[model samples]
Target: MAPTRQMSRPEESTLDLGEFTLKYRGDALPQPELLVIGKRSGRHKAVHTFVNILDNDGNLVRQAAITPDIASFIFGSFEVRGSTEAFNIYESDLVVGKWSPRTRTNVSPDLVRHQRTIAEQSFTATGGKLAHHWPIFQKLKETGFGSIIRATLTLHQLCSSNCPFCSTILRNKRDSVSLTEAQAFVSTLYNEQAALNRNEFVRYNEEYRRLTGTDIRLKGLILSGGGQPNLWPHFSEFVRWLGELDLDVGLITNGFPPKIAEDVYERFKWVRLSITPESASPFYPDGRFDRQYIPASLRHNDSLTVGLSYVYGPWTDDDMLKRLDASAHENGFRYVRLLTDCNLTRQAQLKAHQDLADRLFRLGFIDEVGKPLSRIFHQLKYHGSQREAEELWSDGQCKLQSYNVFWDTTGHEENGYSHCYPCDSVTVLADEQGETDISVSERRFNADKWGTVKSTEVHRLFTEPLQPFFDPRDICASCLFMNNNRAVSDLVKRASYGDMNLDTSLEHLNFP
Candidate 1:
């Protein structure tokens, strides 16, 4: 293809086809460079389209018919190794497909319009602040051995409190991950020490290349546990060491602890303090407001957002709400999240939260506007009845397990601290007190164990699938990740038909 004749003024030219005329205008620097394509009949209006041509100089390189070869050339060039060529079509504000040479056939106008509608709906469903979970596309594409977006690292198995509803209490009998082992595990992930399969790397690399023209690496690490994470003897040191790595670290702690260094404390992106009477009474005898849960220094820390987590259940009442409200105000806490006690039945859990929310509003803890007043957070709303919750559980396999993982300190006594559970929710259930309603076996608590991390490589648990001791379908009755799992499964099914590009960056929405 070669540059056509230069226009006299306005940088516009027209090529008259029998049915329509292709009018091109403008220099390369501007956006939405107008290309007016008019119908041959004088009755209809000229349809304006935005066209970014092959060359950077914005020149209409050649006057050619709309053939397969011309369509391929007109589309931007993106080289795929095994494929001959790739082209991108920008229509109705939706960028669709990376067509290979073999599939460079012209897309019908009707199909393009339909894609725009679907794309808009998808964007509406996704791309809604932090809830936008486009990372599932990459997660689904890679299947079992793919990228690990976010992880929960249980620093230790020791706790300062014995809460009545402690689910992982049984797992706490085992030893915790020592400072040395914790450092090694984190370093390995950050440095990519474990070799990925050649084919796996190529497949992941191609998808990344298509979406983000460059590499994007993001993995969120939450320092939480089977026991209190803050109770870990080396908590301060481990947190300090974590600052040196490239991971985005979040903390889930029971605010009472050996004070962390001012600088190290600020390294966390967000800090969630789980404040319960049972957990708080041991450290702060007076109450939740006995001491500042988050340090005063971090109160105004621009980078930090501290939140309080309170579980509402059978024992919860108006007095507890008053105490929680007073405590949140006393401390410099910004948000107070109310959660349902997982120990209750699904129906009971839903009713408990609804009742709590209603009580919270009536007590002025939450505003009349159905939002947090100045302290409380608008908790995660649970709509629908018990039957709806049950149906969601039966959707399919837990696909979100491939994206995020739970790493705790329980493993074989002979081996070091190494146990990779599906997620924190599962770990809690597997360790919950005798015979859960979900499973018939009384020993279901001990059924879902993955072998020691050291023997099969800790990182491989994410990239490589190892045999699991328990099937989630059989044992897991209540699923916290049911919605996420369903969303991912739907996206996987959609992407299989090759309709959309997932519109996600390598680092986009990695917390899933």
Candidate 2:
């Protein structure tokens, strides 16, 4: 297991609303620049425009905007209210404005939505998947926000390996869950999966069309488990199910084999590449877990979007530079190509670490240095409260901020790690060309598996306001703890945890 990193100073964020607080970046500039915009809620119209604003502090600053025909609040403002977040726009003290009504009759609906700043619309042509995708083209439909929306025909997805580079490999079979234990775990997992799948994880496939009158399609699905995905026996079947969706399907897996890689690549447009081997070490599976890697044809220049994850350890070496060289190559992937690492060695191992960091920094190779790298990259992908596994989500920590959501199989407390979630899940993104994309997801726990939604109520219990909450699995994974420091052979504990106090005993790992 890797060392469990602790929150610096045991001081919650400087701005403590309660037990929950916002840790200042400790930046000299502790304020955010404020932006103000005017709205158009003209007279003689029934439309009611809302007033709100945000200041240097995260608190909502007050303002008003009203216009004719279209009535709404200023964008990026008006985040706080009563009833609920989505509505509460104008119930009281609302402001109004009047301006010329404009229309882009020549532009497409998706582009028009982009201009309106709607949450998500990836079915557009040119900038995204082929225009033929989604309920696009003929007449794109919109599903209004609802109390209960979505229905996922759930399935179980798997990790390909038992011992992945970033996860806990186990103390052995005895150290890991037995077949009976795993089955029980699955039972609990399914119960929760069902509830969540029905709630927010809607499906709009052929079967889905038969299931409902509204066009609110399935939003998010998982192809991973408590263990490595590839190792899951029913993986191929799950892939086939995803293909049947004919809509956007998502997957989170350690890039181990080219088989799953190729299949997912050919089918889905996005993926997360978690592991990038650094130094060669005997402690690993005879360097098999620690040596270097050479991914096949990174220079494709295809439409595929990839997130690169790099974890650093006290042992990280020159492998990062090599990967960077390949990634930046002509045929390399169009990626938010991320790299971050951790050094899990004792003081002795770190002796040469700083020197190497300096050298790499000089060579523009500082990315392969430590937790900070993964933290930044992961922040770019996920919005989970407990994100930032090591100092980063080297790819697992490297979640999809854009078009994604977080789902935990275990109903645990939010990991008090510092990481950012910059995804389009709740918002929308439009490039210079007016191509836009959006994603809506649930922060499910212990329901990452597919087969069935085990305990839907588990979502409500963890004391989190995540939507479509569900139950949890019986057996849990130590890797989820990821606070291991007494790692032995082939047990490549990830750096995301933290400094392994070499002084601790194996029994202190809190493992069975």
RMSD of each: 28.4, 23.4
lDDT at position 47, candidate 2: 13
TM-score of each: 0.62, 0.34
For candidate 1, the per-residue lDDT at 240 reads 82
Q: Evaluated with lDDT, which candidate comes out highest?
A: 1
Candidate 1: pairs in clash: 145-463
| Tens-digit per-residue lDDT, 47-140, candidate 1 | 2222222222212222222233333333323112100111112231122323222211221222211111221222111222122434335554
RMSD of 2: 23.4
Task: List, residue by residue over 247-358, the lDDT tens digit for candidate 2.
Answer: 4444445554544454444555444444433221212243343232324433353655444444432223455545544453433543323322111111111212333344
Cα displacement (angstroms), candidate 1, residue 216, comes to 6.4
What lDDT score belongs to each candidate, Candidate 1 first? 0.47, 0.27
